[model samples]
Target: MSAALPHAPARALNNLVTQGWNQLARVYNSPVLQRVAYQPPQDEIIEQLRIAGIRRIADVGCGTGILASRIQQELAPDLIYGCDASVGMLRQAQARSDQVRWINRQAENLGLDDGAVDAVVSTHAFHFFDHAPALTEFHRILSPGGLLAIVLNNPRSRFARLLQPTMVQGLAYFPPPDEMRTLVEAAGFRITEQRPVRRPIPDQLVPDILTVARRG
Candidate 1:
């Protein structure tokens, strides 16, 4: 005779994972589901830079350096720096040789020289910068014509709704894409491109949006 998994037992296990991600997302300033959706917003960043001819990058608020590592492998940025507010997450990020320089600092106020980097990117960390001085810092570090890619999760989806009061209601979310474009353009970036990076899960039917742009 063979044994099959009990229905409730499976559900309980699933709940543990759901709860873990939920709690993580709660503490997380960025979107957990969106970050994991499609190899995260970092991969999209590298592809855009490849198109734009950027050779260096700075990943502000780079949680665990998920995107930083991808950029290092794809393009071999001569100068790559990963800065974040959380020392704990910064420590856990993949670090090997001179591939990346990880610094524990706030993104809005990067203390780097003017036009220090070729591009600046972040995945799902845009809304976390309402009062943080990092937006100007992004402009300070980026060279003229450098690419700036910011990926945020679009909460307008059925799965986000089903989660109901939890995700949509709890997070300190900002307004829609027009507002994001307005803010970035006001920060001196030309706002080159914007679109959704949709990653579909079979059971959960919400798609994440990965927004990309440039720094003029």
Candidate 2:
């Protein structure tokens, strides 16, 4: 089991994550930053969604609506919604497209009906989430057999370890692969896929983790 973070440090981390993401809302979608951030496993995720006959999907932690917009165009889902905790981020997303239903909300408290979506995709933002609660919320919001795909920084990587201090300083966290899987499974998901991919950061390459599961 993972060691629990101290209350003070945990709160500090949450604050930093909230502030940093809100601050990054302005530059998040820039081509430079996009290249640095981990990209989602789009092909695999799309294939899974297609196989499951998904009609409605939500992008939690949908920054600037980039992934949500792409899913809208590519998958052509009937309803594509985007939610984020930061108003600044939501503003950017809302500005990008009118087709997506943009909601300013936390991952743990998504103001949506139970089983309202067929799938939920979150990219490069898991480190900032309150894992247990967010996963529970994901399970609650998803239809039976609904999919959950998360793309996050891989803390197991050498590069990521070197970057941990900075991230921790910012009040974010990168959970180990096993820990993340456990949390998801404990939240009532059945893991289907988990792996890592190398993504280019500004000055170096960093590993990104991908995990896909189904609400069971």
- Window of ten residues with lowest summed lDDT in model 2: 1-10
lDDT by residue for model 1 (80-128), tens: 8886655445554534334777765557566678999988888755545
The TM-score leader among the candidates is 2
Query: Ten-residue segment with the worst summed lDDT in candidate 1?
Result: 1-10
lDDT of 2 by residue, 30-133 (tens): 77666555343454466667787788999888877888877787878899988877666777777787888887677888878999998998887777888898
Model 1 / residue 4 / CA error / Å: 50
lDDT of each: 0.63, 0.76
RMSD in Å for model 1: 11.3
Can you tell me which runs of candidate 2 are displaced by over 4 Å? 1-15, 40-44, 198-204
